[model samples]
Target: MLNSTQVSYFTLGAYFDTKQVKYVLFLILLCLYVLIVGSNVLLIMVICVKRSLHEPMYMFLCSLFVNELYGSTGLFPFLLVQILSDVHIISAPLCFLQIFCLYTYAGVEFCNLAVMSYDRYLAICHPLQYHALMSLKKVALFIAAAWITAFLIVTTTTSLSFSLPLCGNFINKVYCDNYSIVKLACSDTTVNNIYGLISTALVVFVSVGLILYTYMRILKVCFSGSKQTRQKAVSTCTPHLASLVNFSFGICFEVLQSRFNMSSTPGAVKVLLSLYYVTCQPLFNPVMYGVKLSTIRSMWKRLFWVKLK
Candidate 1:
């Protein structure tokens, strides 16, 4: 483990030495990154050009696409380089920064998804107040809050990363992460690990809870109204629900994979799982929302035609 306080350090482990799938994995990840970025970029261009899509849902989606872009970026490039290079070298500071970027984007995106889900809740459950509640001013404030919260979480996470001392094992997953990164330090990862678990659980639980609760309330309100009202409410909430379910599944997979025993964990598998979190999951957001929403489709067509014109 290399000490975080040390001016510098060298990597100690080989890349999946016996694992033959490294090249295949690298190619697969590269393809995923391209699609994730391409899809989100297309969505952004669509919203920007379609004057009719100047609505709250599309605006929220635009924010999500931005989050997915940064989220994937924080981890994929480094992973791709390391996989292709056969060189397991990364300086401590650079590693920390990488984890910081990854965490910040992940945090912000989680909050934004909750906000989007809540917006849907309002539209379905409280039609009378939806416009006022999700007004431009309120949405702007929410966006600002999402950013502030992202920074605050990053501060806590980074402080934990910097405070830890690593010495013996420097191996980590392909996707750089706070806990895995901190484990590289020779010192005890107890503090960092515990902090990660608590922080992650709190964030995931809270955001997921709020979204679920809001939807539950929406279902209740819909049930009390007409048959048509109930069906419409379900239709309105379906996109938000589907997106939330997928997001939850990704977060759950990451939590499971990241909990390797610090003493005997395999670095190669760690890298593979980390790659899954960083690379495989982000496009899920764009797929769930961008493809399902008709308004987004119309907006895309209009935006592209306008651009060509």
Candidate 2:
């Protein structure tokens, strides 16, 4: 019978008794956090410091790396703390804040990818006009728009969920989620549901449409162009395509877990699937881009070698 205001904390029911293995879990997660932070920060620094990388593509990449860092930070530290503590409770305010951070991170991730695809499209399909189309100023604007729009959309989402009158304070997941909270509302969630549907549709459709359209155009150009052009397209677009597919799969798993009843599923598998998108994408993108993209790969290697000397 408690409303949201009366609900001081939320219990995260997803965590199980790891017994003494929590220490092992903690160490493993800590290493993962370090790796994610280190790899992403390294790429960001490389993109920013290298004068040769000061192009639209790298700039978009830098933004992507930054978002990976932002998104990972939203989850890892809190997750680390919860892993050790017996109590998996998060304060209502902190729960809302995490929702804001994570949701915004997701929104920005998709938008950023869409923007990068367009940048690639312009680079390969319209080489002469690439610079003009994706100038530094425009790149800056695109990055800003991606971030700002995500913030605004997630802001509305979080606010709507926060204002709901909750009948309970138990979230069945390891972290805060807007849908889970909305489902806990004692009052009507018609507005929240409507807005959620609309925002999700817009974000998904727009970002996916842009990515598909740009890739289609890029593919058309590649097929008709010279061998060198085809090679260039393959080289540049492989990592991006891989990244998009990987993230999409992770998101699909999460959405399915969230929206559907998966109680019959194994608990461990469910937990992993729930965390796959946020956890894997941060680690995945850095590795994929670092290894696949020669510019970043060579730059990081040269810098490491210089330091070794």
- The numbered model that scores best in lDDT is 2
Q: lDDT for each of the candidates?
A: 0.72, 0.92
How much is the lDDT of residue 222 in candidate 2?
87
lDDT of 2 by residue, 1-309 (tens): 788889999999999999999999999999999999999998898888899999998899889889999999999999999999999999999999999999998899899999999999999999998888889999999999999999999999998988899999889999998899999999999999999999998777899999999999999998899999999999899999998898889889999999999989987788899899889999998899899888888998899899999
Compute the lDDT for candidate 1.
0.72
Alpha-carbon runs more than 4 Å astray in model 1? 7-14, 17-26, 184-194, 261-272, 301-309
**What is the Cα-based lDDT of residue 89 in candidate 1?**
80
Residues 199-272, model 1: lDDT tens digits: 77766778888887887887788778789878776655676677666666666666777674544656655545
Q: Candidate 2 versus the native: TM-score?
A: 0.98
